[model samples]
Target: MAAPIDLELKKAFSELQVKMIDTQQKVKLADLQIDQLTRVQKHAKLTHTEITTLPDNTRLYEGVGRMFILQSKEEINNQLMDKQKTADEKIKELEQKKVYLERSVKEAEDNIREMLLSRRAQ
Candidate 1:
């Protein structure tokens, strides 16, 4: 009977360990996504500037030049905005996961403590 209870406790601890690892991985992925979004935003700004700086006399300049430039800028701005939104959402999710994982770890610790105390009492 004691052996079965010990085995069950060990399985529970093992499962918690796996969940902790998965939570850590999710946090790292979120951090990387945020970094990627920041870089993309910076690149989009630089590209928009380059496109705008083309002189009217330039051979590559096409019909409705100003309109084209504005459209391009708007597109880049929209992409950046989208990336930022995604990053923000990912970060929020990661924070929630971290909180939940922390709580789970704490609970596991409490369980272990209780088990030990019970053993000692016996």
Candidate 2:
């Protein structure tokens, strides 16, 4: 009886270890994505500032694949704003995912503790 219980506990522990590792990897990925998004947002802000300083008569040609489309300053500003907004949203989503993953890890740890306590009581 004790041998069977011990094997079961060992299996459960290994499974939990695997889950913890997977969660850690996911958290690291989320952190990396957040960092990239922040860098993108910063670059977009710099571009916006430079564009704002340019003269109205200066022609801005936005490259779209094989062609460059002539665009107004307002249009460029709007594009930058959109980029910034999208980056912000993606960062927020990654942060939320990190939080959720952390919460799940905590719960798994608590469950393991309870299981250990119950086994000891038995």
Candidate 3:
């Protein structure tokens, strides 16, 4: 009886450890993606600011596939807005996912602690 219980407990611990590791990895990945998106959004905002400060009639060129194409100020502003919007959306989604992953990890840790306490009591 004791041997079987020990084996089961070990198995459970192994599984929980695996789950925690997986969740941690996922959280790290989400953090990295969020960081990248944030940088992109920041860059877009800065570029938009610079563009706004320029003369209205100043010629502007937008980059496309390693080449610059002449574009109007309005078009460039529109593109920057789009970029910011898209980055915001993606960052929001990743943040939500990170929350979920963190919750799962916390739950798994609690479960492991509960299991240990129960085994000790027994």
Error of 2 at 58 (Å): 1.7
Candidate 3 on 26-120: residue-level lDDT in tens?
A: 98999999999999999999999999999999999998899999999999999999999999999999999989988887887798788778878
lDDT of 2 by residue, 1-122 (tens): 78887887888789889989999999999999999999999999999999999999889988899999999999999999999999999999999999999999899888888888988999
In candidate 1, which residue pairs get closer than 3 Å at backbone N, Cα or C atoms, i.e. clash?
none
lDDT of 1 by residue, 69-94 (tens): 33344454466567556756766776
Top candidate when judged by TM-score against the true structure: 2
Please state the error at residue 109 of candidate 3 in Å.
1.8
lDDT score of residue 40 within candidate 1? 66
lDDT of 2: 0.93
TM-scores for every candidate against the unseen true structure: 0.53, 0.91, 0.90
Q: Alpha carbon lDDT of residue 81, candidate 1?
A: 61
Please tell me which model should have the higher lDDT, number 1 or number 2. Answer: 2
Q: Number of clashes in every candidate structure? A: 0, 0, 0
Clashes of 2: 0
Which candidate order results from sorting by lDDT in descending order? 2, 3, 1
